[model samples]
Target: MRVSIKDIALKCNLSVSTVSRALNGDYGVKSATRTSVMKVAKELGYVPNIAAKELVSQKSKLIGIILNESDGDGEARPAFFELLPHINKTLAIFNYRAIIYTINSNSYIRGEITDIINLRNLSGCIVVSVFRENHPIYEDIKSLNNPIVVLESSILTRICSNINTDEVMGGYMATRYLIDNGHKQIGFVNGPQNFEISNERFEGFQKAIEESQLQISDTAIIWSNYTGSGGKDSIHQLIQNNPAITAVFFANDLMAMGAISSMAESGILVPKDISIIGYDGLFVCKYYNPPLASVVIDNAAIGVRAAELLLELINGGSGKTVRVMPKLFEGKSVRKY
Candidate 1:
């Protein structure tokens, strides 16, 4: 019951080849003829078959991806869950399909990326792994002919496009907010060691603390993996080291949530006993018993922009290094100190 290009051509009384070329916006089709073909195509409700088009074009029309898949049934991070849809939706706009290549952190091996990419015939690739420094795939990634876009904080390789926020600025903003809030004993809960985002954010935190001349104890800064268990486990060590700390800036929202929950379980109330501000503005933050204040980056925007950059690279363009800024969202968790 669907209308076809042949139907449009028949109605317009034009050759099938001429109708096809005009519909595709190919050269050699007259403007008047192209317009007529479109008018007829629209009238007939003719939809271009993407699958058929791709077959003829001899391109996969599929965007390849590498995402971290947990080995166990542990909960996924909020960032990955939210980011997947935005990437798919953005790719849909360009009539492209997304093909996920999930990998466990331990399973990533050298030359594996190249093998899969070539086998899939991917038009381009996006690496969504939340990485630590010197990601293992660096060399193999460089050897691929396909374009790559990484969500890493640094330009780890020459061939890939990297997109990340100014984590240092984010850290600065959070710390300065605490200082301006009349809280002198501000604490910081950092992410795992060697994470570029975590290090940058910590650097910014240090800058603000030094500028404010605020006293910081070794116990006040906690190093945590960007996970709930990590956050929960880290807080006791921190509080035992610096019992007088008032406000804490968490590197990511997930850890913040865990810290707050752990604090509550230990009979401490948020903002009353301590104030917490988290990075990564997840939607679930709003529903927290007391909404969590956070630094919100445009993760959705980052995904789309990375896709755009990769597509450009696929079309013979060079990758450019870019950084996006984040904004602070004031939620109910932070009290006026």
Candidate 2:
């Protein structure tokens, strides 16, 4: 049986109007009366009707989580899986709900995103995708009045804020570790050049090489999609063209794991013939035969910060960008010279 406000009002010997105001935290209800109503409502296990509340308040209290399928081939990576639950839990604490919306990079046209938000009546939204500066969605995003938070991209609008792991730092940390181990002939397997993260990480890689005074050949760098197969292809190309390469850095763990198998198939032993390290400290890395070394991006922190920022924006706060630092997880994948 559902417990309604009418039942509580009757028990309290009060009118329905008085009970409604108190239940909704509206002004004019005495503290004692509000407390009594809440206590009785809890005892009766009352669940507020969200539709009714929204109708009365003219607010949806619903948040949209928009993700772009950048890889468009339908192979979705679980990169944001850990981060989303945290965001949902944080929003729930404030009586808000999260709805997921996916956009395909290949199919998404201009103004499509704006239509989703307006039609869904979302109070605000968080976007997680790999978008180049020239992506058409930015025009739609910039014109929105609602609050928005974007993860892992450089796009920022007056109403849109950004949250990301410190990609440059993560890249530098991974590469410097290889350098410290005395690997001079290092190769880099990065993601598609269109993604901002791929470029930022490469910047860090360049910084580390410059600081170490190591001269890396132009042929040593390769770009691919953030997929296992892409990693395998890139590593094979990187090594076959630059056989002097003694170690390599992958922009993601999936690619790193793929490269390991590719090397084994080619009769090259990891850390013995060629050393390697990866990014994205996925838990599965520790279980690998050689244990992958990676820079851990704290997705939990990003989720919490993103939720907070969205709430802040809904409440009329100004938008701002936030960056969480990545930590290095050392493993046995790299060999010391």
TM-score of each: 0.84, 0.87
Candidate 1 residue pairs in backbone clash: none
Q: TM-score of the candidate numbered 2?
A: 0.87
Show model 1 residue runs off by greater than 4 Å.
1-57, 71-73, 156-159
Compute the lDDT for candidate 1. Answer: 0.80
lDDT, each prediction: 0.80, 0.86
- Candidate 2 collision pairs: none
Q: Which candidate is the best by TM-score?
A: 2
lDDT of 1 by residue, 192-285 (tens): 7677888999998999999988889877888888888777777777787778888889998888898899999999999798888889889888
Model 2 bad stretches (over 4 Å): 1-49, 70-72
lDDT of 2 by residue, 1-337 (tens): 8888899999999999888877765434677998898899999999998788888767677888888765624556667787889999888766678999888767788888888887878888998766666678877888888889988876677678999999999999999999999999999999888888999999999999999999999899998888889888899899889988999999999899988998898898887888889998987888986999999888888899999888878766778889999999888899898
Identify the candidate with maximal lDDT.
Answer: 2
Estimate the TM-score for candidate 1. Answer: 0.84
